[model samples]
Target: MTSKTIASSEPSIIESIDQLFLRFIVGKNKIYKEEEYNDGLSEAEQDDKELGLPAAEEKSGWNQRILLEVEKDRVKRVEADKRLKDKRNALLMRYFQQSLLKVVNDKLENSESVISDQLQLRENTVELLKKLLAGEPRYSVLASLLELNPGTRNRLLSLVSSEDFMKALGRDPRNVRDIQTAIGMIGTDVLRFLVPAILFKYRINAYSHHNTLFAKKLWRYEMTLGQTCTALMHDINYRRPYEGMLLSAMVNFAYVASYQQYLSSFEVVRTACLDQAREKGEKNRHDFFYDIKTDSASLQALLVSQADLKLSLALSEKLFQKSFPHLVNALKEEVEGLAYEERTTVGKILFKAVRFAKYDQLRSSRLFKPEWQDDYLADSYIEQDVFKNLLRQELFRFKPTWS
Candidate 1:
């Protein structure tokens, strides 16, 4: 009875349901149309136009607002990517530092004592002599004569007893004192040849037995450079091939020693990297391993001095003095006052040889070749065709002996 006359603003139940459905449809259509309109305008323009702004103002505001937001988002994304890259690089550097420290610490802990060091030195010398004498009939005969036989009274007696030994030494046993004197003289002369060969072999062994990857890389580089240098000197008819060989071998050995010293200062290196990152920014941080500033002259001096001393101790004083009378003096003069031209020549040859060897190693090992940037060697040296053929010959002969 209360609803007998329906008000204009109110409706019956069925009419109310139909009105609700119609409103729902109308709302959905309006939303769809608004979406279509919004698709044609920028977000800023859509909002401004919906709020009843003029078309010109909407267009102008749209460009500025949208561009600002896009620029802000782009900046944020770039910063995020940079942070991610820096974090990854830092982690990688930390891992390398840790690994290097472990290697250096292990080497230090297991370093041999003085007596053991002497024994190892003697053993290396003996092994080098054996290798030097292994394949040659004449050298083998001389080596046999040099060996002490308990069956005989001494080395002299052993040599006198053997016909081949005396023959190789170009001595007659008819005069025992003369034979002894001749053997002494021959031994002294032979030592000149033997010493350099022995030192070279020792260097090769030292490089081969290194426990680290970087050491191993240095070893390969040394081998390639030494061989190439020696061959180049020979090809150029250099009067001092032995000097060239000794110098090349010493350069690499000294570098390795210096690098080891650097590695021993791993804590300093890590701190330096951190400081560099903080001060110069992460992108400008120094690569500690590759960026080590080795004093070439100092390294050369140290190596040459040690070599002179060691060779004197290892060989008979008379033999060493007679054979290498000016070795120390010559080395001192060359290393101390090395001319720019001379340094450039040697450095260039070595650089080219090392580069070639690196590429060869990479190709042979099926490893990825990184972009070969100009490193320390390149900084100090320029490539030339001075020893191109010689380098090729040496590389051809110098097969990879490393695992």
Candidate 2:
């Protein structure tokens, strides 16, 4: 009966001790054991407690929750970084465009001084420069203006019409009232476009028929220049764009000078988009490079380099035709259709044709007289009072002899 039946052969004391030690360690982490697990219970209580099960499960759950939260934070940070990068790129592009416009405006402002030095005229001496060198209206004013001191030109340009003053200075007459009362006052010059000086020139030139010749001529010059500016501002491919725009702007400024109805016309053209302006510009492109050949940058640059001279020559021809037709005809044989109205439009349409046509011969022909020289002729007797009185008489008498 006493056959060593030790309660189902209880495991060795060492094995029991090992299990108990494992229980204690797990409970120490607060997973398997309560705060007072040992207060009233020993090995018997541990056997019924089930301490290790729930704590092990909960610890694993907490680790997974921490990992998920960290991943979410990382995603939020990535989105924030992306937004900052886009904002920086937009600001830089606008700065470049403004710089280009500023440079253009500055050069135009300096155009007056350049004209003065080139003409070899004294800074303040009055001179009557014709408005046309050929059939087209001459930008002779523009050319002459380039030689005058920019400061003086700009200063006078602001005070009144420099063209009028120059005319007066040349002993041409101008009217003060007419200049003051005219409509349209978008002034680009340093002075008011309708200054007394400008009116003086208008008065002298506005006389009827033959007497109105100079005034009409100056007006046409303004229109031609306005057309040019319209072309340059709208035509992306326009050849010699800078010079053309400058010429055009100067002319538009002149209209502002005369206080002519042309101011509205100039604005209409200026506000038009490229598509509409192209139609108008097409008519004026005959003299200079109207556009770059297709899209060739090299060709475009070349055209720009020669633009000023080529345009000047073309304008010279136009001015000469109006200012001195016999001279133009004497210089070269007239084309068969040139006198026809239809052919006149054709002449404009095919301005480039001049490069290859008989007109080229005329354009390239040498001047037969010193009076017909390409340079501006200076007349020293041009006086403001004499010019103003003449202008008043011309305006009052539609056919005044002195005008």
Which candidate comes out best when scored by lDDT? 1
RMSD of each: 30.2, 38.4
Per-model TM against the reference: 0.33, 0.18
Q: Quick one: how many clashes does candidate 1 have?
A: 0
lDDT of 2: 0.29
Tens-place lDDT digits, model 1, residues 265-292: 5546556556656677555454543443
Residue 152 accuracy (lDDT) in model 2: 37
**Candidate 2 per-residue C-alpha lDDT over 1-403 given as tens digits, one digit per residue, 9 for 90 to 100:** 0012257667532233223322332121222322343422454345334322223355475464443687667756654653453343223223322333333323323334323322122433223222211112223443354245343334333433435444443433322322222111212221222222232333223443321333443343333332222232233353322222223222123222222212222233233323453667743332212221111122122223322233233323433345434323322221222322333322222221211111111112221222422221111121344333322332221110111
Error of 2 at 305 (Å): 34
